[model samples]
Every structure is written in C-alpha cells, then in structure tokens.
Target: MSVSHETRDGVAIVTLQNPPVNGLGLATRRGLVEALAHALADASVEAIVVTGGARAFSGGADIRELNRPESGMEPTLPTVIAAFENSSKPVVAAIEGLALGGGLELALGMHHRVAGSRAQIGLPEVKLGLLPGAGGTQRLPRAVGLETAVNMIISGAPVAAGKLAQSRLFDRVVDTDVVQAAIEVAKEAAASGELHKVRDWTVEHPEAAVFLASARTAVAAASAHYPAPLRCLDAIEAAVNLPFDQGIETERAAFADLIQTPESKALRHAFFSERAAGKIADVGADVAVREVKQVGVVGAGTMGAGISMNFLNAGIPVTLLETSQDALDRGLATIRRNYEGSAKKGKLTAEQVEQRMGLLTPTLEYADLKHADLIVEAVFEEYSVKESVFSQLDAVARPGAILASNTSTLDVDRIAAFTGRPQDVLGLHFFSPANVMKLLEVVRGKATAKDVLATVMALSKKIGKTAVVSGVCDGFIGNRMIEQYSRQAGFLLDEGALPQQIDRAMEAFGFAMGPFRMGDLAGNDIGWAIRKRRYVEKPHMTYSKTADLLCELGRYGQKTGAGWYDYRPGDRTAHPSQLVNELIERHSTDIGLVRRAISDGEIVERLVYALVNEGAQLLQEDIASKASDIDIVYLAGYGFPVWRGGPMFYADTVGLDKVVAAMRRYGKGHEGAAWEPAPLLLQLAEAGRTFNP
Candidate 1:
C-alpha cells in the first residue's frame, strides 16, 4: 500500500505511505492516482489533503527505478499531476521534511500548497543532470518569482517553506502539524468552490529579457563542463515567455533530450555508484555496528588535523595525539584556522566555532585514548612508523576499539601484524584534507572482523563520508588505479606532450586537474618518492625519467615555486616552465624515441583506459567486488568529473568494444605491454557487454 486513505472532518487524506521519503515510483504513482480518484468519487469527502509523512513529503522519484520499466511506470508522474489539476475536489499539498526534485514538482501540481514552516522545497533534478519533467518549470515560476525559481532549479538547493510562504507557492505555512493545516486549507478551498491551480497563475517579471540574457552568459561560463544547468535555465526561460502548456512542452522536451545525454547518464551513474559503494556484500545488517562515542587520532599533521575535524563537526569528542607539544599546538591551530575560515564565510558563527574546537583534547600520551571506541593513526606513510604507532595503540586501546591506519599505500595486513588484536586493525585511508573529502577507503585485512568493517561503514555515514570497502592491496582502490592513470600521463610527457596540453585535454574531458597539475599541487616530491620505491621493487616496470630529472634539479612543486609548472609566491596558478619542457624533450631523446604531435583524444583515451583496464584486472583479482565500487573511488576521491562518471562507467558509456579497439591502437604506438587489455576487459568487450551491466 503506497498510499493510505482516511477522512478528517469533511476532507479526505490521501497520505503517501511510502516510507523513507515517499519516492514517486511505479507503485506510488499508481497508488496516488487511485487514492485521488477514490477521494473525488466519495460524496462525503468535501476536499482532499495529500501528504507523505512528517519525516519527508517526498525526496523525488525513486532513483532505483532509473533505466528500468519502473522509471516510466504506468500512472506516470505527469499523469498523476494532471489528475490533481483536474480533480473536482480541491487538492492541497501538505509538504514537510524534504520536497525535492519530483517531490516539489508533485506539490506544484496540486490545486494549492499548504506546507509546514520547516519544510524544505526545491526542484533538484539538475543534480542528476536533468530538469524537472512533470510541469515544475511551468508551475514554479508562476508561484515563486522567476529569479528565485531559476536559482532553486539550477542550484538544486532547498529553501524553507516559511521563506516562500508569502509567495503564491504556498496557500498556508504552519508550524503545527502540516497535515492538519492542509486539511483546513483544503476545506476552505472547497468552501470557496475554487480549485486554485498553480498553472493558472501567470509568471510576472519586470526585466526578464535582460536577466535571462545575462544569466545565460554567466551560466555558460560557470557550467562549461556541465550541460544540465544551462539546459535547466532554458526550460525555466520558457516559463517566463511561454504559456503554461507551452512551458510544460518545453520542459518535457528538454528533459527528454537531457536524459539521453552522456552527461546525464554519467551523473546518474555517479549518484548510484556512491550509494552502492556503502553496501558491503559480506557485512549483513545482523553484524553489530559499534557506537563510536569518542575518537582518537594519533598524529598532529595536516591529515591528523583534518581527520579530527570530521569527528568534532559531528559533535563527537576527539583526543588528538602528537609527540611534541609544539606539533600538537600547530595541529590545534590548523583546526581553528579552518573553522574560523568557515566563520568568515558565514557558514559558522563564532560560538559554533568555539563549540567544535572545545570538543578537541590534545594529548602527548596514548593512555588518553583508552576509552576511545575508534582510534585512527594518521602519522606517516612508512612501515616502521605505523609499526610503532599500532604497537602502542594495541597496548593502550580498549579490547573492542577499532584501530585504523590512515596509510595511503602501505600494507594494512602487515600493520595489523604489529598489533595483538589483528581483527581491530584496518585501513581508514582518507584523502588529503580528510574532513572535506567524502571518500574513505575502508581497507579490510585478512583478519579484519565483519563487525569492525560494518561499524566503520556505519560511522562513515554519521561523519558524512562515502565509505567503500576495499580488500587489502597496495594503494588500496583509488590510489592503485590512479597509479596507472599517472603512468600514462608521464608517458605522454615523455612522448612530447606538454604539461598544459595534457592538463587541458584532461580538463576538457572533465577532470578538475590533469596528473601534472595535480602533482604540482600535491607536491611532485611525494610522487618522486613513490616512483623511487616502485623503481626499486618493480625493476622491469617502464617509467619516464623526465620527472626524476626535474626532482633531481631540486624542483619539488608549488612548495618549491616550480615543478612541471611555475607558480608565483602567493598564487596557485600553474605557469608553463620552459626548464621542465626542455627536460621532457631531452628525456624523450635519451629514450631513443622520436617526439611527435599527440592529439587530445589520444591523451584522454590513454589515461582513462589505463584506469578502466586496471579496474577490470582488480575485479578479476577480487580486489574490488563491483565495478560501481571502483567508479565511486574515482568519483569521490580522485576528482573524476561527475559528468563523465568514473573510469569504468565512462568506459561503459563509450562501448567496451570501442574502448578495446582504442586501447589496441594505442598499444601499437607506445607501451604496448601496459595497453594490453585485462582478461575481464577483453571478455566483456568480446561479448559486446559493459563493465557495469
């Protein structure tokens, strides 16, 4: 029963009973139509009050229905909205909690809207790279002003109902039970004999032409990589110039076109992939998740400070440990600076900043962490350092406490060996600036307990992170795959591709920054050390010596004012360095290779396919269970553009057979061994199947 029916006074209550934010899916859409019909037929019911419980009126269409029969289910959202507009009895929406995307559109479709003061409303389909298709663009502008509606639609952020209550969007906004308020509004509308529809209202704007023209310019510049926001504005523009019916036609047409777009498909893939990464197949709901009341972080560096902020922001007390008092003070100062920066931006108040900082307890001893339910070591990326930290943690931490290492590429299994309780040891690899980054790779060691895995995954949600479970491997999931992408980038440089050229190509493909730019930002010295280690361990592996030559000349990166690109003392902008370009040329000559012009297509194909190929191999090796999990790692941590999805999803988008063909073409050119498709990749390509499906 997706919808439950009851009568209050002379009003019929058609409550959307779908739990967890009544999503407008197949069952719910059919149920809504049936409930409305029943209400309209009943002579006893004077008016109709539609609602979806207090927790959420609706979050939108169930995304689980995407690309399925359920997505275009019978009694579609359009059909349901039409029913509300044509209803003989007055229909009023009782909106509360979240009325986002399709949920907000459903509310606009009713005769009138009666919302709770706290209700958050917005059309957020643009987040999934699509515009609202169910008459929202036509109706919302007629209710709220064009500027407000356009902003809401494009940004996909919600506004409190109280703020928009003065507008025609809401008939009434009450703090007391929204359903009761809606019933009263419905009765009044019925008494007046006016089923006031949102569509009937005209959109009024004084300078619509000037505003839209300027908006088009601004959005075009800001959303060059993303097509949805600009498309969203076009649909909204129709609401201003065109009639209600015409606007709807425009909206639906735009939605249809956008839905088929690769960008939209990619965004949808990323949305689903992020959620999929949280669910570990082996860890069932029956596995007990430990309550992490107090947290301990065993370092006072940048990573340690950032990790501590996550717990502090979540209102959980944290004990931050460092060897020296000066280091502890520096870490505490860094945390305050971050919080104060937020305060300056009006994201936090002075009181809230102090409140969060007050929760931090700086310590010089491990004994202070005995009562902590979870302890993370964010020290250094060395085996000896981790052994020292874990051994001390094993001695001092409570019996059931989860001990985690924040190692980017170190072996988690060996780190677990340093501790007596191997089951408690796992890797909680947070990217740099741990608090801000959403990806938390939960590396499960051979001895890692299911409960330990489940607890960390559950805790990740509380702290606002997408936790993906990874089987123990060097570089884990994101770093491991990125290693290949970086290798291709270096090889591209060795083959005469300039730093900016490769970066521009990747940027055009929707990467935030190319490997060289990222390396410069993250410090080229870090990769130099990793490559140095890999060169010793993997003697037969091929690598371009251009980066090594640059490092040897003592050019680190932004920290040293130069690396692949030069930077001004205070600015982060990457200016091309002739010194590095000359080094790349010399290295190409030294390798006995003829330097040639490389196309942007070649750069993107080589780098992204490198990821796709390695991801397939990881799947075959059982390092990753699902393809979507690999996508999530790149999407969340590695700055893979949301519009391109992750490497695997993007490969699926390009057709695996085509991807394989392109890889073979590149293999014939350079690094043929690296370009050889993985067994799983070849199998899927030959079968004319995708990595995801």
Candidate 2:
C-alpha cells in the first residue's frame, strides 16, 4: 500500500506503506502505480517525491511471487518505472535503508535520486538466478556508465549511498529525512526546468566493448554451470548496442526466458529454503533469546580459536579456557597472527585488531568460566572426552549459560545427557575454518531449550553466519548427506570411472569442487578418522572398503601430496594418480568386481541420487525442517552450485519417479544395503510428487 497526495507547494509525495522489507508485491505494486498515476494526473503538481514506509525503502521483488507464477500479479516495477521515466512532472526518488533489485530500478527511472545516510542500492537479481528486467539494464548504464554498472550487476554487490553518490548515479545524497530532501530537490529541478528523460542520456564508455568482453570471460570462469550471469551479460550488451526500446524488449525476453528455466526454479527454492530453515519444530517466533554478554570457550585449538574470534567480532567478551599455558599460548599466538594478517591484508585496521584482542582473556583454568554467560566446548570428537569437558563446564559455568559442542559427527544427545543442565546443552557444528565459513548447523538435542536455540540463531546472524537448525543425529544434516555423496563417488571409482572423470563430471554439473578434490583439500585422513570411529561404534554399519585401502597406503590428501589424486608441490591442481588407479583395479579384481566404462550421465545420476536419497531421509525423520535446508547446507557449506539450487532441486528436475526406478534398479543389482532409496523418496515418487513440494 502507498499514500499519494499533492503537497501545498505543488509537490506530490508518494510513500510506500508496506511493513518489513516492503517487497513490491501485487498490492504494493498496484498501490505504487496508482499513486504515480494520481500524481501525474494532477496538473498543479510540479514534481513528485517517492519514499518508503519506515527504514527499508524496499528489499526487491517479493520473492514469494518469484515462484508463484499463478499469482497473476505482475510486478508493477516495469510499469511504474516506464511512467516515471516518461512523466511530464519531474519524479525524484528518496531512498532510505536498502533499495535493491527492482527497488533500485524504480529509483533509476526517476529524474533524480536522493539517498539517506544509511541507504544502500544494488541489483542482486543474479543471486536468485535472475537479471533485473525493469529497465535496470538500460537505465543503470546511462546513469553509472558501462564498466561500473556491469560489475555491480554481475557481482550483486550493494554500494553505500555515499559511494553511489561518488559514482554519480544519485543526483544528491544527504544525511536527513530523504523525503524532505527529495521534495527540495524536486522543487529546484522543476524551477530550473530540468524535467528531462534519463533514457535520453547517452551511454558512451570508451572501453564498453573491452569491459563487456572481460565480464563475459570472468562470469563464464566464475559461473560455469549457471546461465543467469551469462544472460545478465547479454542484457547489458543489449543496452550498450541496441536502442532504448529494443533493449527493454531484450530484457523482457531474457527475463521471460529465465522465468521458465530450471535454474531459476532451483535458485528460488533455495531462497525460500534458507528462510524456512530458521523455523524449528518446537520453537516458534515467540521464543525468547537469552542475553549473552560474555562467552566461555573450552579447548583453544583451531576450532576453539575460530569460534572465539566470532564472539569477539560480535563485540562479545570471551574467556578462552585451555588445559595448559603452552597450549593456550599457541592458541593466543594463532589468534593474534590471524588478526594481524587480516590487518596486513587491509581487511581490518590495526586499531580494530587491537580492540578485538583486548576482548579476549586467555586462562589455563576451568574456574575462569564461572562468570561466563555462555560456554561452548570444541574439544576432541571422542564422546568420553567431550563428556568430561561438559561435566566440568556444567559445574563451573554460571546458571543459564548455554553449553554448546562443536562436534561435526558426534551425537549431541549423548553429550547433553552427560551434563546436569541438559536443557541448556545443544550442538553448534561449525564448518572447517569456522571463521571463514558462513554455515553453522545448530543441532537441537532432546532437551535443548527453545530460548537456547533462538539465542544461537540470533547470534549466528550477529556473527555474519547463517544458522540452519537441525534435529540431533549422527552427522546431522550436512555430514550425513556428504556421507552418501562420498559413497557414490567411491562407488564410481570402484566401477570403471577414473577419479579425474568423476571429478570433472561433478564440477561440470555445477559443483564448485568435486568430492575427490574437496577430500584432498580438507585432508583424506579426516574421513578416515570418521569412518574408523563409526565402524568401531557400530560394526554392523556399512563401511566402504575402498577408502580404507587408500588410507592404509598413507595417501591422506593434498597435505600428504597424495590421495585419490596426486597434488604437485605448491600447486592445487588434482591429477588422477596412476598408483591409485592400479590399486583400485587390483582391489576390484580381488573383490570379483568387473570394471566397465561408466558414462558421465551415470556418474552424475548416481552421486546426485545418493544426495537426494539422504535428503529425503533427513526430511522424513525431521532431521531437517524442509528439503531446502539440505540445499542450503550443501550450497553454503559443501560448495553445491547456487544455480542448481541444491541436491533436492536437482532431484525435482530429474523427476522423482525416475530417481526411484533408478535407485531400485541399482539396489537390486547390488545388495539392498548399497543403493536403497529413502522411504520418503519412494513415497513422493509413488505419489508422483517432487522433493520441493
């Protein structure tokens, strides 16, 4: 909804009244169009000021509508922008907070743009497998020139209002009520007779061709599987060469094309899936979050230090507790070096680094945790070792302090059961190099309090991390899926496919890195340790004999210069090892398995189906809230390509019935244990339903 009226001085003000992000949905779009039409109809009005509800000007097109094609609600952005550009009276955009995607396009249509102190603008359509279709491609180039426009659009990066003003995109930027400032600018522009069309503004960058060519190459390299970036480049090029109206038609055609694409559907699924992942089974929006001012970190190793870094970065004081001065000193030295290195790299200032360092108080005692409000343990993966840590933490940490474990593949329930305050115990599984990774799997044990989960979720955002709430299970969401993915890859290798062929297939399918390459990067010994642990716990559980053979040969990974692939010293390129190939051949012959050439299609389907099967199981068991949560984990943590959306989205494109038949066929050929389809997958497949549903 929006309000429109002619002011006393012949200036019309149009204010969007939608709450939250004010995403331009059907009603909001209709309201905007009507408001503009009313302003344009009034002969007394000399100029118009476009503003927003409260803080946020707009987030973008209402994402809900992106997938709801049957809504019959075309975004009013294109129509409103066309009217604004062709209006008789000057239209001034007054931006506050974020004006992103179609929101920026709306501003670009106006004769002048005035942004507030905290205003940010960008075209982030690429993130959602889209390019701006509402005159953004044509007008932005005219406003900011070609090079800067293409970079901003392709990267989907937001530029601050101050920075945008320097780019000469916005006519003026001020630290005042944007509406009033826009009104003043509107009056001056009207008086000066500056009511000219922005479309008439020529876009003549001397290096336009070079910039577009470079952008095409860069985008192709960065996004090999995704079509959105390439399509975005095409639209930008249309704006450069084609006339204004033709560019607009080109944009519309491109947008319509993307709307029908599987990539767009998948990406849209991911966007909603991340939002849905925050919803917990027992926890509601009304759940209260605890006030955590001070934090206690146990085991100051790599995980512990990185976890503590997040706390300090969030401006929370931390008490880093270790067993010995030598260990504590090493942790402290690593923390200092990390911060100093960041400062050297221009990521942080020396002053900021010093300030963060001041927040940390390292102690070689459990007693130091007494005053802490939240205590997180990042000790060894052994349950007994973790139990001991939790027992001491429960005794010393203040009442109401949340006890968290950074265990990637351990049972959260077992750890919580060992503690007296089980209700306050939960799992905070941070991905490797925790400080760098954005995904944090927040596992809820049987007794984890609602407030505890909320606090952790809020804290994840505070530290610039996306927390996916998961029900406690061995490996939780991510590792469990990876287990299946790894199995599929190993099976492919055991069959006729080489490591190089398997890696190339997966990477070509849009994965940033293949399982083998990823394994090498993280060290193969990690998986070996996990497998060894699992086999010890449950001897009946299935174990891959192939990985064990590789481990036995001391082929760890890139760190050891050998794994499935050989790593050249000082180089990251993973080449298929002849030694590994020979070993696999001998092992296959020993096991009475005949090697046969495998197609890339078979490799892709096997690995993808493995992930899809596990994802279905997770969803059925309520380990994950939705199929999208699994996708988010893979996309953010496991380098699953953003364009394919995630494993489940890919499954939908493949068709559930087909996946079920393939899994059944494979299961029959192998043992039932080898290629068993998840019951959920079977159920959905039988019903002819998709995982996305």
TM-score of each predicted structure versus truth = 0.98, 0.94
Clashing pairs in 2: none
lDDT, candidate 1, 1-693, per-residue tens: 999999888899988888889999899999999998888888899999888888889998887787788778678888888888889899889998879888888888888888888889988888898888888788888899988888888888889999998998988889998888888888789889987888888788899989989888988998877788888888888888888888888888898899889888988888888878888888888998888999999998999999999999999999999999999999999999999999999999999999999999999999999999999999978899999999899999999999999999989999999999999889999988798998999999999999999999999999999988888888888888888998899899888799999999999888888898999888888888999999898887787788888899888889999889988989999999998888899889988889999999999999999999999989998889899999999888889988888899889988999999988888887677788789999999999999887
Error of 2 at 173 (Å): 1.7
Winning candidate number (lDDT)? 1
Deviating ranges (above 4 Å) for candidate 1 = none
Candidate RMSDs in Å, in order, are 1.5, 2.3
Cα deviation in Å at residue 180, candidate 2? Answer: 2.5
Best by TM-score: 1
TM-score of 1: 0.98
lDDT of 2 by residue, 405-504 (tens): 9999888999998888999999999987888898999999988888999999988889888889888888999998889888878776676777788889
Predictions in order: lDDT: 0.89, 0.85
Q: Write down the RMSD of candidate 1 (Cα, Å).
A: 1.5
